[model samples]
Target: MLLLGLFSHLLSSGKFWTTRRTNASQHIDIRFVFVIFFLLKWSHAQGSHPPRIVEHPIDTTVPRHEPATLNCKAEGSPTPTIQWFKDGVPLKILPGSHRITLPAGGLFFLKNDEPSASLKIFSADKDGLELEVKGAAPTVLRDEFRLEPQNTRIAQGDTALLECAAPRGIPEPAVSWKKGGQKLDLDSTKRIRIVDGGNLAIQDARQSDEGQYQCIAKNPVGVRESVLATLKVHVKPFIIRGPHDQTVLEGSSVTFPCRVGGDPMPDVLWLRTASGGNMPLDRVSVLEDRSLRLERVTIADEGEYSCEADNVVGAISAMGTLTVFAPPKFIQRPISKSIELGADTSFECRASGNPRPTLFWTIKNNRTIVFPGAPPLDRFQSINTEEGHSILTLTNFQRTDRDLVVVCNAMNEVATITARAQLTLDSQEDRPPPIIIAGPVNQTLPVKSLATLQCKAIGLPNPTISWYRDGIPVHPNAKVNITAAGDLIISDLDRKEDQGLYTCVASSRTGKSTWSGYLRIEVPTNPNIKFYRAPEQTKCPNAPGQPTILNASANALTIV
Candidate 1:
């Protein structure tokens, strides 16, 4: 089909030239005819067709300094020579030229300027065809900015948006953003991103995100930057160093340190939570360093306090407790008294302090005798009552105790104090010494059995009896019981722990007596036990067999 079309086109061209031919033109026409005959014979011999364009170059847009192509394909017997022309003039498309012709009659626009015009294509002895080729419009970007980002202010943890766009250009300008004169890497962080039309979006804005932002647009022709925009991030109040619980002495000064930070400097406030009011300005004041200072703090000022920091964004608070300690002071003193010999007398003492002082009694006449640690004297009893109150009683006073003095002491972590009272007797009475009538004797008991030791004493005044093992006091518990008659009883006695020397003590104000005895534990021995020696053998005749038990109990077992 291509061969027929080429032959027809050649005949038409010959006819056209003949109608307008002169003598010289006719001569050239005859040569043209011979060339056509030779082309037809070559086409038949090589089994080839005349040049025919299959695809033609179409209209297209190309950016400046960017590569592009205009395609044109043709077929022929001798591979027809393809030529390109613009505006009906042949185009000089050379090697290394910006506008160069392809091997198949296509035009290639290298990285350079492109022009829009009508393109013409022609093959050997073939009619020419025209197609429109166009370059990109607005190839050079304008100097003025198209869109600019404005100053943005947002709260922390909120999304921030900054919009930017480039001016019209042949090759659209690339848009980017920079912070504080440094290019922002959108791929390095997940919080910042470039969105629609090169707009910048920052999620979860933080304090570090506050800076000057600028948008940049660049193309082959030129580059432009938007006006610098400042980003302000509002942060809530945060406490860096808050108040802490502390203890201070009364009448002393103390300071509670507080430090806070925020975008809009937060205000600090000190409050007493116990009284549900602000700190009394009379003695307490807030220093320039944001610390609460209290001068000469008293017990009444000891309570829970709060340090509050507030800003436009939010508010926060911290609590601390102040503990004030005071030294011991006596509120009541014991009065001196005189009593008949052998008659009981009592003295009462009381004191007060910030920490509820401890009250105890001591005899100050001859030597210091601390109550609860005094020797066994039933006649002299010292009782501690409710809340800093104590009572000291002297019963059956003897002649040698006439000029004795009783002392009451109060103490706490802060300080200690003492008060003394003199006791005078009208007349002295003689008292008999303490004597042990019945005492514990040495005895042996079996394991897991019960045992009891007896101790009885007599004196002018009833004596107090106490039991001990190897000088260690024995207190009553579930397994050990001390009866009113001074008898020590032990149940479920252990073989190893319950064997020791026991002592009994009987004491009174005048004198004292003691009796000691040893306790032994008996353990039952196995009945079926015997001692034997086995002869040492150098070699064994047979291997030992597995043993089997015939009888078994908790204590012993038999195996064969």
Candidate 2:
């Protein structure tokens, strides 16, 4: 009962507690034991509250050689001791290392140091969160730093992408494009854009966009440039200067010049359609300047010529007209001929010229013949043939057609020529009387002087002439005789008897005709005799052994 009461008192005790020992000599204070147990359990609970970090040191990004900070916060009973570690090792504050440390028992920070460090926080009990410092430096690398699309060719209206290939760089480079040493207006030009702010893009490019392009990169690391890229905008061939209309003479050499222009140098070819077909280009030659040369061009070489230039984009051509000139020429000419009565006789004339010529025929006593109709004269026919061949035919030739002369005239815009021929008809009855072809004119002559008269006539069998004086037949005398050529000749004759009208008569199988004219004989006039007439002949002073000559006075001498 006493022990029970004691145990109950111990249980009921607030401040002190009692305990029993297994050995009597072993005496221990129950209050002391309870205090010792409470102390140990409190210690265990305090140790159980490890460093509970509510905020860990976060990663920070900073530029090189700049000030930055990393923060850390934690909680624990008995106040955890804060420390900093880098890369799993404790970090000690170094002298003059430009590092800042915060004063705190549960929160701390690092400042003014390189961000390259991987920081962490740890208490005396456990490790907290990991920390990171990101450091960046603006620098340009060597590789992948060139202008894209180097030496590229594109057509007009095509899109061009010109990029600065700077794949890896710090502080991202700003790309700018230039052409022909001039900056491009990326903001103003609607079709030109800076793609992703790193590449130059051109949409619907034209010939003006063809040039050397450069890409420039600028940043805090200074400026860097990429190699120049050639951008070519192809276009169809254009003929700036070429052969125009040309005029040249035949049998002469000629050259046609052409200039072709495009984005890329264009090739040129010459073609011509001339002289009934395409020109034999194999025989022709081309000069270094792309001029077509023809060695001795003829009239047949006149036609239209063309110069064509081609490239990958398209083709262009220009036309030139060639005019070759030649003088008029006769291929067939009119010829002289004689036809029997009621026979057909035709004359033909053919000519060639640069321009086709007009043909016409004209007769001596007939009307001219032209195109669109036959000969106007009866029994005459006009025929037109190919290649300027003209024919004039005379049918049933009559006496009127004898000794007829005809002419073939060919004329063009440049030249004119004519061919003439005579036509004769074989007819007898309808022929006129004997006609005199040639004769001598009648004139006065001195008495006792040699005189001759000629008469020429033409007939079928020829004609003879009869000489007459004063309308009387004259007999042949010693000084007067008739020649075989129907010529009357008198060596010496008396003026009174020989001076009279003269006539020539001609006869033919058809008829006879005579022509007369007065042929007066001239007489010599004597000088008048003086009143004191001297002797007819007088002798003057004579030389030795020489006969004396007498000077006859014309005024004093008279014929007996």
Candidate 3:
């Protein structure tokens, strides 16, 4: 019985020790799980904050000689200590070489060390620098730029646009525009505007807008200009007067006007249509202010006219018509008076005006006739106005009709005028017969003798006395004497032939009268006859009253 009680006490003591060890192991495992959960939560919260930036806030673009700022910030427990590094080396604080100041209350300051702060630079290169903060470097720049409106065209009234851009720049560039060296002025009314991309814009375009345009972009480190872009504005010429056409009198005047508008003033010209001839032109006149003028217009002046305007940029033209006008007046005299008969006669009938008038002769017999000559008489004639004042001669005046009339007529010109006269016949009592007479009918006459002759006449207007001999009209010669008492006396007659017939004549308007006279001469017979007989003498014959011949030497014999 004593050995069984000692074995039961040893088993109970072993059970209590196993239970205490199990409880202690469970408490240690729970504590380890709680610590692991807190660590994971803290790591996730730190990742949510923005990364610390240490380079320039703006990127890639800067103008030369302009101010640039560098930034350095940190995000950590107790604000982790901040420092700067360049080219993989730590920077030391130096006196007078570095100016450090805190703008924002962060655990960092700006570095003003010009030489040390400068990043790697390339004149044409656009890439920016990488900055290191707290032994870690991050890329801090994003930049983009472009010019707007690749290509475009515009008419005079239409609108147009030009643009430039840089979406994001480290330091945004100032943008501007120029055309052929002149700056552009912008207006909202003109539809011109500028935007964020640094673009240049043009709203309305005209022919004057057709040229080169330049776009400029500038930043702190440098400035850039874009290649020239050309714009073209197209337009046609406009006519001021709608199809200006007209007609005018041939000897008058005409005018045509043309007007145009553009950036550059356009040229204007006038041209003709028929021969394509150009009209001479000058600057607008004060009187008419038109493009053309035609004075003293004529048929040859009729034609179409063209108005043309042009510039180095463009050109245009318009057309018009012109017409000319012509009209008719009298050319010769119509009145005449005073003419005669048995002689030539003529009259003039001339009518004066524009367009010559036709002339004809109208006789008193109511007959219309051309002039009497072979070819025909002209408008004028000459007549003798002597005896019959108003009489027109028909050549030899015969016992024809009494009152004759002569009229000159101009057809389609004027009224006619007539000239007339009365014809008279001669009387027989006004005519006279010729006369003759004779006297002094003896032949033989003594030296001193008287001769007488008688004269008579017959005529209408009385005849005068005159005598002629040997073809001479009885004028006194050297030794001849004449008396007005109607008798001839001869003082001493030397020859028997001195006695002959003499003639006396008288004449008058009606006829002629003539007379003749004669005279005789006598001589005494011989008183004594003496005869001488020579040695041998011949006998003479003796007839009827013959006397016998008696001869004596010294004495005379008488015969009875």
Candidate 4:
């Protein structure tokens, strides 16, 4: 009871207390507490307090030749004594070392001459309770690079990251970047910045950003420059010059110019726009200059064409139109034929052209025959067949229609062509006198009015026909012509030369027939029709209608 009372009195007076020490020196304090516990043979009481730390030594860093300090402080009853240790060994101020213990339970180094060291603090009172604090040594740097940026590639308008790191140093190295030997200014642009332990990041990378890059680390110890790295910025594909519209003749060659620009060279292809089909490998080729070439183009090859360019970045296309033309060509031609009296005969002509073709017929004199107009004597007709074909038919063949010629003309924007054919009478054993079957009559027509006269004749053997106007041999022209059946037609009749006598003659080896007609042109007045003024005759007019035989044979005759 007396011993317990004495322990209580000591605890109440705060003479008995416990102290805490750093992990490194904790065992020293624990043994001291055990020795006190065994000597007193008593337990601690609530009236006294355990040694509690008010300040603890913390981790520290300093220059190689500079002084350093680690702060530590504690409080307890009966004032604790502070002690220092290193690596579980009691620390003491050696003769040559600058390390020493501080009065405030801290550690201090007058000069940091060693590479690295750690210090721990212990504080205890006479009762053997303890407390602790610990501190770390200064840090040092390394000599070699740990990581470096590497070559990289990225497309434009995308993010790019380049990693870099420097070796540890007394004063940490400063990381920077260089492009094409020029220093990168991170503060000047928001698109570029440093991150993730000295890694370079570029947002919305552009073509100008492509170049050799390097990572630089600088310190008092040394300077480090990473290996040169390449940064490639790719651009989307685009067309500079595209194909153009073209018009060419069939069987000719054509070319389409295609020029493109990109980071990497783009590939070009020619495609048919309508069908989206690939170009024909046999006739179409891509040139070294990136132009498209087509050899021996045809009508079927005409259409919308497109040239497409593509690369790893993107694709582009351009379009143009192609036109092909063909000249007129004859598919079927007129052929000469022989027909019997009163028999019908026809001539056919067919042609082909790119724009189709128009057809027309011409008579023996090469005078174009007006279409859809009734033949003077209802003995001739012209018919249009298919797109580019025509036919000329003769009805009720007569002797005067012998030795007739006809031609078929096909025309288009490209060219014009004609096919010619002749008609002859079949052989007949009996020969008879030529007689007139139809005769022309006199008529007075208005000026500029069309006039036509018919004169038909027949004989055992067909007869040759001829015409004369006002004592002169009638010449067929654009305004006048003689039909195969011995007829005459006058268009846009003028009073000056067309108002005169017209005569028709049919002749054969046996005999001859004749007919005459007068076309008097009159100008219509308000009240009465007046005859067109005629030139006065100096002397008697020659008999132009008189027939003169140019050539004669046993079965035929040609007259002028």
Candidate 1 structure quality by residue, lDDT tens digits, 1-560 = 55566555645563321111112110011111111112333344557555556676554444445677767776666665565655345568776678877786776767645344332222344333222222222234555676899998887898999998866653678899999999999988999998997789999999899999999998775677999999999887888999899899989998898899988989998889766675667998888989999999988888988889987767899888999999888889998765556887888988888787888887876665556434545467677765557878777877667667889898899999999887765421334446676778787766787877878786645689999998999999989999998989999988677789899999877567899988877764644433221222224233356444333222343456
Expressed as tens digits, the lDDT of each residue in 1-560 for candidate 3 is: 22123224434344221001111111110000000000112222333432234333322222222334444444433233444443323445565543342443121223221221223211111221122222111111123345444455566766656666643332456777777877777653345566545565555656677787777666554555666777777654455553378867656777776767544566676666685573433321313344576677766666787777776556778888876544211122322322232433434444322122234445654453544232432322323222212212244433342233455443332233333322232223333433442222344444444333334443333446665432345554443434453333344544443555556666654456556555444442323422221111124232356443221111232233
TM-score of each prediction: 0.43, 0.46, 0.30, 0.44
Better of 2 and 4 by lDDT: 4
Q: Tell me the tens digit of each residue's lDDT in model 2 across 1-560.
A: 33234334544554331222221111111110100000112233424443444554443333334455545555555455555544345556676655556654221223332323322222111223222222222133233464454776777887888766653444566778788878888778799888765777889989788899887776554566677899888876789888788877777788888888886678898888666557756557889889888778887778888998988777889888988876678998998775666788889889888777888787767765545256446776666777568888877888677777888888877788988987765444445556554343465666677666666565544667777777798667898888776666777856787767777778866577676656566555534422221111124232244322221121221111
Candidate 2 Cα errors over 4 Å, as ranges: 1-150, 155-185, 194-200, 203-229, 233-237, 260-267, 274-290, 310-315, 428-560
Q: Which residue pairs show backbone clashes in model 2?
A: none
Best by TM-score: 2
Q: What is the RMSD, in Å, between candidate 4 and the native fold over all Cα?
A: 21.6
Q: List the residue pairs that clash in candidate 1.
A: 138-169, 138-170, 139-170
Candidate 4, 1-560: lDDT as tens digits: 43355445555664333333322210011111211111122236555444456776555534455677766676554345566555445557777688776787666778765444433333334445433333322333454568877888777888889888876654578889999999999888999999987889999999888898888887654566888889888876788999999988789999989998887888887789554564666898889988888999877788888888887767889998988778878899998776777899989888887777788787865365835334633467887854556778888988777777888888878789888887777543334456676666788778787887877776646687888887688888999888888778889988898988888888876677888988888776535765533222235364467554433333566566
Prediction RMSDs, each to the true structure:
25.9, 23.2, 31.1, 21.6
Candidate 3 displacement at residue 344 in angstroms:
36
Off by over 4 Å in 4: 1-56, 59-205, 211-231, 271-286, 295-305, 340-344, 364-366, 369-388, 392-403, 424-560
Best-matching candidate per lDDT: 1
Q: How good is model 3 by TM-score?
A: 0.30
